[model samples]
Target: MAEALANPELRPRLEAFDSYPDATPPPLAATEELTIPGPHGPVPVRIYWPGGTPSEPRQGLVWLHGGAFRFGDLDMQEADWTARNLADRAGAVVVSVDYRLAVEGVTYPIPLDDVVASMHWARQNTADLGISSISLGGASAGANLAAGAALRLRDEDDWKPEHLILVYPSMHVDLPEPSKSLQLALTEMLPAMRLPPEMFHSMRENYLGALISNPPAYAMPGLADLDGLPPTLVLNAEYDDLRASGEAFSASLAAAGVDVEQVLVRGVLHGFLNLSTSFEPVDDAVNRIAGRLRAAGQNP
Candidate 1:
């Protein structure tokens, strides 16, 4: 993949970023592929049930993958591998949602609606699935969707996630600018990591369509009132433009009196979650997510 980029010298680092030391996914007790009813149609999902017998109601996680709202699938490492890892470590049922991407006639609410529906389905079936609770989480654009759905669930239905996990998310339509030190470091180290505002504007426009002129708060979650939301974990990549948004959103969550933990991973670019578990930060982030989910289930 790096061969196609302007900097061929980056091939080694980029390859390492993409490859896991062990390509095989961690073992799971079981995995089921099925469809959940959605407003638009059926939303496909993969459920990763952890290995071993449960002593109590296991935790559940409703997860989504990032692709700028137009790309990605349940098969991506961020969705499948992460779900498997989380399930194994947290001993939780990880529901990886194949929510509708924003493409062609599909737009903002359509994709977000799919996620909300999936969450409702997961929560309603917790007992049948032998899980006590479920949390909502995602990476990048998927994180944007997760946050938007969290607000919708809170306002529209007075429902809230047990926990929220956001990884390298770009939450705002108007993103916060990177600090001078960050900008300098990115330019000096990985200039390709710099994302122009126009790119983000275009990504939002592509996702929002006609709603681009006046997107609702749920459509651009950073614009929403974040009060009454559940505890959250925000992981931002060290060298990504979207780190600004993650940092800003973390601050917003804290100001809203939400329990929020923000971690800025060093020496990495965005979407590192898609990389192999051999990457120390990626492994650590997944472990942290697992530990939190496990604790939430136990406490609840």
Candidate 2:
């Protein structure tokens, strides 16, 4: 992203996520851009509704996009496509959240706060929003935020999400082994899949100052308490360095006796979720998520 910003030719295309990229899988019946008040400012959100008569009381989802807490937007191709597809597949109203990014050296808790606030806002207006059951889905950095919010909600005696949908979540900021890092660094040369081990260090710094200070475990889900959380569905990519951590997190959740299911997609790397066109695995992952949400029912 830094390099993209440096080159004048690519800056606009990189910054403007709305008209940036294209991916066609399924079309949404309706799309809406709306906002809710936040501690920082008005948080922008995009809503997707499936085609057909709305269900008696719509099932809803609160989605967070992944950009390492600094790279994504509501209009980004992956975010938009996932929202639309989930709306169509799950028969639920999907709300894609555009929370405050931790750019310019912003500290921890802000992004999580924004997400939790958005959930509160949505829940408060559930009747107005025409939704009964609510679930949470997020990818990469968004997954981190979703899990953190789930923890917060559980601790506060707030309404827990019916389920958690996480895709390639960056759960731990720890450095990988030299060989693993080398493999990740080499894989970036592959077409369309981008995951650099070094970037994780920088992202951790950018999001939460220095690791020496040791921020709360919520900043990194792998270090947090996993008990009393919502049922979680964690999806990981085979070649992703973060896969190890995500899998460990899942195991921890299971050990804690929390309901958890994890799927490891072979022959793919981090950011695989965004390569639906180039990769066939994306559809299977999406379908699995939708099916899980559908089975979660209107109230669970």
Candidate 3:
């Protein structure tokens, strides 16, 4: 763990966000900008279709951006790049959603409502989008939305996604029992990563609103009944706090007879996917997701 932290390449890029330098955005073919009406207000979405082969029907992916549910938008450079990469790599149309943040909206059901609306919108426009099947996925808080969306879709709408992908998702508000190695890793990495404990508590409080009496399984996927969720791929950083949540979610899925794949990427931290230069694990995880999509598309 010490050696991993001491790696110069990893050290600098991890701290890059502190200074927040701007870099060139990845080139995408074309983006259709539009607003989908939600209960709260207009929810913005950017639809990205890869350049080439418009003749064939494609797979669709509804991408939720991550910012701990407090600070992300569809227009961010990282989100745009992720959409473009997923579209190009998976040969799928990507609809990136700009859902209401918890800080602004302050509620339990609001974010989940937006996610469900986004999914419905994507499904309704499948003909125009030229896709037969759809998947839901995201990184961090986005993955939280994906998990919640899947549950809501199954229970409320009786619809199932073709696939679900979670990248270092925060599925539980509670921390897991710490193993010795995990403890060591967290001790070294948490301080270095500069994740404030108070900030997380604030985010959770904002998302839960006043309805904190009972922990809803919808808010925490690990607590939910995982009987009918789609086949899932859960990716986690070995040193991330969310690692336990991902593992627990995977175990729940397996116990409920759901097909599940969980991958732990070593020597990576939370939000690594956003750091393109420093995070080689993101590329590998994306490739795996694309392969899974291809197989699902072929079989479905």
Candidate 4:
């Protein structure tokens, strides 16, 4: 498996994620870098305020970036670009969490604790931040943490997020079987672009450690009860393997009577949101996300 991942044949496809074109993020009214107290330690965060003076209180979002749990940071396009676009378009304040990665000795509950702490900070300071409501969301592994944090908040604090914006998340410990058409579509993808089942298995091992066999309740939220999670917007990449997990989780959310919107973004691969803002799908997804955040503030 390691050999396959290291194959020179896959280099170009792999490099695309790091080398993809990026444009300057739209200007925000202000961007602040701060640290909030966390269970593990202080968690760093970058906050992006909307560019305009708003007539009403804005929505607040705690956003996390994705790297299969161990590889992303606040500066990544998934974090910076996504936050900037959402703040600008949604007219909301976006707090991008620099949660601890699941690496070295860090594992379950550490990153989760960071996300939970960030949410608490955002919620407690909502008034000062000029936001009326708060939502929790992320992409891929970050999405997993967002969902886990939401469940933790629900059970431990009896608090509920205003909404969830999961972008191409991997929610299941075991990747669900893809539909026949999806399998065929995935076959056309480059080797490095596809997230094989083994990759998910390895990620689970790294993130969950010895508990992967019987992970805790919120570690893999797709397999947990979803009774009262907030209205969720799940965006799945049309050609990504994790689409199965996203689709299944959305179905479970609906089954549990939670409001859920599942959108399969067409003709895109995994981590599409991390690409340049010029990408049409990325633009469209940001618009949809901002629209949702705006609605949450207006109605809440």
Candidate 4, residues 1-300: lDDT per residue as tens digits?
A: 455357675443344445554556687889999999998889999999888778888889999999999899988878888898888888889999999999888999789989999998998998989998999999999999999999999999999989998999988889888878788878767676677668779999999998999998789998899998989999998889999999889899999999899988876779988776566776788899988997895444
How close is each model in CA RMSD to the real structure? 2.4, 6.2, 3.1, 3.7
Among residues 3 or more apart in sequence or in different chains, the pairs in candidate 1 whose N, CA or C atoms overlap within 3 Å are: none
Candidate 4 segments exceeding 4 Å error: 1-22, 298-300
Model 1 lDDT at residue 112 = 94
Candidate 2 ranges beyond 4 A from true positions: 1-25, 175-197, 210-212, 298-300
Minimum summed lDDT over a 10-residue window in model 1 is located at 1-10
Over all chains combined, what TM-score does candidate 3 have? 0.89
Q: On residues 81-195, what C-alpha lDDT tens digit does candidate 1 reach at each position?
A: 8999999999999999999988878898999999999998997898878888889999999999999999999998898989999999989888887777667656745545577
Each prediction's Cα lDDT score?
0.87, 0.77, 0.79, 0.86
**Per-residue accuracy of model 2 over 129-201 as CA lDDT, tens digit each:** 7787788979989999999898888888556888998898877778434346436543543322345557767
Q: Write model 3 residue lDDT over 1-300, tens digit each, in one string.
A: 355448775565455433321365435578899899888788899999877876678889898888988888886644777787778887888999998888855687888788899998998989998898999998888898899999999999999889998988888777566456666767766354645667766667778777655658888776788998999999888777667777777887899999999898776777766656334566787788778777666544
**Which pairs in model 4 have colliding backbones?**
none
What's the TM-score of each model vs. the native? 0.93, 0.84, 0.89, 0.92
The better candidate by TM-score, 1 or 4, is 1
lDDT agreement of model 2 with the native = 0.77
